[model samples]
Target: MKLHGYFRSSAAYRVRIALNLKGVPYEHATVHLLKGEHRTEAWRARHPQGRVPALETDEGAFLIQSPAILEWIEERWPRPPLLPEDALERARVRAVCAIVACDIHPLNNLATLGWLKERLGADQAAVDAWYAHWITEGFAAIERLLAPGPYAFGETPGMADLHIVPQVFNARRFSVPLEAFPRIRAVDEACAAHPAFAAAAPENQPDAA
Candidate 1:
């Protein structure tokens, strides 16, 4: 398997953590998003969406989108499971993941920030404000939802951890104050101590600037 990704992408970062936790061995292929490599026609042919973190499986199947790719990773590598066995517990965990993946991440992603700058004439201060507003709103809900634990849902990191850790990275990147979200910061600290999360960090990746 070969994982195509950009070092700083939160979506790509989640998949890296997932694979490491699952103990799956795969090659890493860097797609230089900053250089517009993903926008080239050749890359578009391989991945219609031209996004990072596309997993090329051993069977040569390409998996796109971090959420779907994450689900597939869990299904493909079930041991040390990222989800709980109980149905309701799974939903609760997934809801935490959604808070980051659905509500927070999309609004602050590169394209959205780029559009804010180029299309809407948003200056740095305005862009940072927009980024912090969404993060504060979504993280408040996540803080309430988080379990009193070393991870988002329980003693061990799971799907929720995979999602939140990356967003926390993004939060710090934008200078968003996390003092209001102690639970979220605690989870970040806890995850930092774990090897899987450590190895998947942006600065630890091959292509990190």
Candidate 2:
């Protein structure tokens, strides 16, 4: 498998962690998003939305979207399952993943931020504020949603931890104060110590700037 991704892309980062946790070996193809590589015709052909983290499977299947790719990875390689065995626990984990991937991440992604600045005439300060506000609100809910853990669920890192860690990385990148979310912070710190999470970190990516 080959993953097309940018170093700092949170969506890409999630997929990377999932692959690593599953003990799947894959190659990395860096798409320089900053250089508008994702917008080019060549890239669009590979990914209709021209997004980072498009996975080309060994059988010649192309998978797009971070969440979809994650689910695929879980189903294909189920040994170190990313979801809980209990139905309710699985739902809870999915909810937490949705909170980060659907609610928080979309609002603060590169496209949305660029739109706020370029299309809406918002200045840097305003854009930064918009970024931080969504993160704070989303994180508050996630803090309450998380169970007691060294990981997000219980003893092992699951979907929630995979999603949250990347968002926490983004939160800190934007200088969003995280003192209010102790549970979230603890999960982030815990995941940092895991080899899977640490290896997939943005700084550890080959394309990291």
Candidate 3:
């Protein structure tokens, strides 16, 4: 498998963690978002949306979107399962993933931030405030939703942890105060110590600047 991703992309980071946790070997192809590589025709051919994470499977299937790609990985390789065997527990884990992927991440992604500045004429302060506001609000709900644990859902790292760890990394990068979200912080710390998550970190990526 080959993964086309940017080093700092949170969406890409989530997929990387999932692949690593599942013990799947994949080749990395860097798509430098900051350099506008994702916008080129070459990338558009892989993903119509020109997103950073477009995974080409060993069988030659192309997959896009982090959530969809992760689900595919889980289905294809279920050894170190990323979801619970119970239906309700699986739903709970997916809910937490949605909170980060759907509610929070979309708002603060580079495209959205760029739109706020270029299209709406928002200043740097306004953009930064927008980023923090969404993170704070979304994380508040996530903090309450999370069960007390070293990981988000339970003793083992699951889908929720994959999503949460990357968002926490992004949160700290923006200097968003995490004092109110102790549960999130704990999960992040636990994930950092896990070899799979550690290897998938942005700083550890081959394309990291």
Give one clash count per candidate, in the order shown.
Answer: 0, 0, 0
Clash count for candidate 1 is: 0
Q: lDDT of each model, Cα atoms only?
A: 0.93, 0.94, 0.93
- Candidate 3 lDDT over 85-174, as tens digits, reads 999989988898999999999999988999999999999999999999999999999999998698998899989999999999999999
lDDT, candidate 2, 31-118, per-residue tens:
9999999999999998999888899999999999999999999999998999999999899999999999999999998899999999
TM-score on alpha carbons, each prediction: 0.98, 0.99, 0.98
Residue pairs whose backbone atoms clash in candidate 2:
none
Off by over 4 Å in 2: none
Better of 1 and 2 by lDDT: 2
Error at 142, model 3, angstroms: 0.5
Q: How many backbone collisions does model 3 have?
A: 0
Who is ahead in TM-score, 1 or 2?
2
RMSD of each: 0.8, 0.6, 0.7
